[model samples]
Target: MNMKHVFNSNPLRYTAVLGLFAILLAISCTSEKEPLPDECEGSISLQTTIGSEANCGQSTGSFTVVATGGSAPYTYALNGGTAQSSASFDNLAAGSYTLTVTDNSGCTAEISVNIANQDGVNASISGTTASDCDTPNGSISVSATDGAGPYQYKLNDNAFQSGNTFDGLAPGNYTVTVRDANNCEVSLQATIKSDVVFAQVKNIIQTNCAVSGCHNGTTFPDLRVDNNIVAQASRIKARTGAKTMPPSSSGRSLSDDEIAEIACWVNDGASLN
Candidate 1:
């Protein structure tokens, strides 16, 4: 039979063959479609607000990591350090740092951060000390040549105190720092002369406070005890200045000169005789 005549006679066969070819094509297309890879891609940036450096060699600061053009749910790391979800870091020293951000797709972006100290705080201090064998009284005053106006003061790494003048300090070497409103600081060392002896303080306490149950072992302050003399100097000075001690009804109040003497003693470090 001729090819054309055979094909025309079996139209059903041609239809079946065409249907089979269509099915095979569909299967091939389905098999070629593989799962796509997780594409991680993005960029990172750093923003910072400079933190004020504390007194001495220590410093403080903070920065933030900002990320964009990345997949959702990103993780952050600092200088290849621990991975943290937080984008911000605080209380950092003055120096350089790096931040890296990674997205869910394993794509990473990095940024650099540099920090420097602002010399806004330049402070100097001077003080007078009354150092004699009889009396050891001293005072210190601080001044700032730089930074903001209205500064505060601190002594020997203690908490920041208001005002630049410190009174009733003992005769010794002291470290004083001036901190301005901008939180910048400068430190200075001042030596207060100690001429006042512990013998005088002992005599004064025994003569006035030890009598009539005041500052004796029975009293709350108990000044007769030598161990806590230095510790109570400030409080003793405060009480004496306020005229709250030696109760008015006690019939034996301390004289102004006597109170001043106590201040001098405390300023001299309330030394042990």
Candidate 2:
């Protein structure tokens, strides 16, 4: 069978053969297309730097993130919150958190971080009362624990010092603050009482100038008695102010502060009350 003689003999059959060939060619051209490879494969990565821990009972912690390997202009989201262009997050409390970074190509990476505290600075304060009238012999001491050291101490509005003991404080209410090396601080209150000036002066007189050979029964006015000391209050203030009391032979003399205290009592009317 010759194919050319057969087709020439049947024109309809030749037209049908051409139609089938055209259909087959059209089907081959319309087949499904193959998918292209992903543009961000194995290229999306994230790095982070943790910030300082939160202060005790405060939310001051933070962190920063840097993205690499993907496209530029990355955005960040913390704990699934709204995304932002800034790479840093702040005012966070002590706890665990998840951060996500997304690049311009829609590639994403995630990391976990934690914020913590350095422990609270704890403190206790103690004080001693002024032993004499209108004097500043009072003292305060502070004991600190926890947090970092060596610590610093201060009283009220005074400047900070390395020593925990504050001496020569006047009798009154006071505030003491203790601070650690990390700058964490705690405060407390203390008080010193005012001693009875009349009693204090009588004791000073009896112990120093009212001995058997001095202002006892043998001496005029006999200052061994409290009434006698009160009666001679003005003369006593004058002599003590001149630093001539108790006599150099008696091996005794009143301190400037003690003399001032006696003068203060006399100026205030020298009442036993």
Q: Identify the leading candidate in terms of TM-score.
A: 1
TM-score of model 2 (CA atoms): 0.32
Q: Look at candidate 2 and tell me the lDDT of residue 7.
A: 89
Stretches off by above 4 angstroms in model 1 are 1-188
Give each model a TM-score: 0.33, 0.32
lDDT of 1 by residue, 1-273 (tens): 354664698987767777887876553312222223334465544454544443334555566656667776778887678989877777765444567888777777767664444555666554464554244456888766666777788888788888777777666667776667776655565767656566766666567655543556555555676755555666767766788655554445677766777776776556664
Which runs of model 2 end up more than 4 angstroms from their true locations?
A: 1-118, 197-273
How many Å off is the CA of 272 in candidate 1? 2.4
C-alpha lDDT (0 to 100) for residue 220 of candidate 1 = 52
The number of the candidate with the highest lDDT is 2
125-175 per-residue lDDT for model 2 (tens digits): 654645445556878777777878899998889999999999887655677
Clashes of each: 5, 0
User: How much is 234 displaced in model 1, in angstroms?
Assistant: 2.1
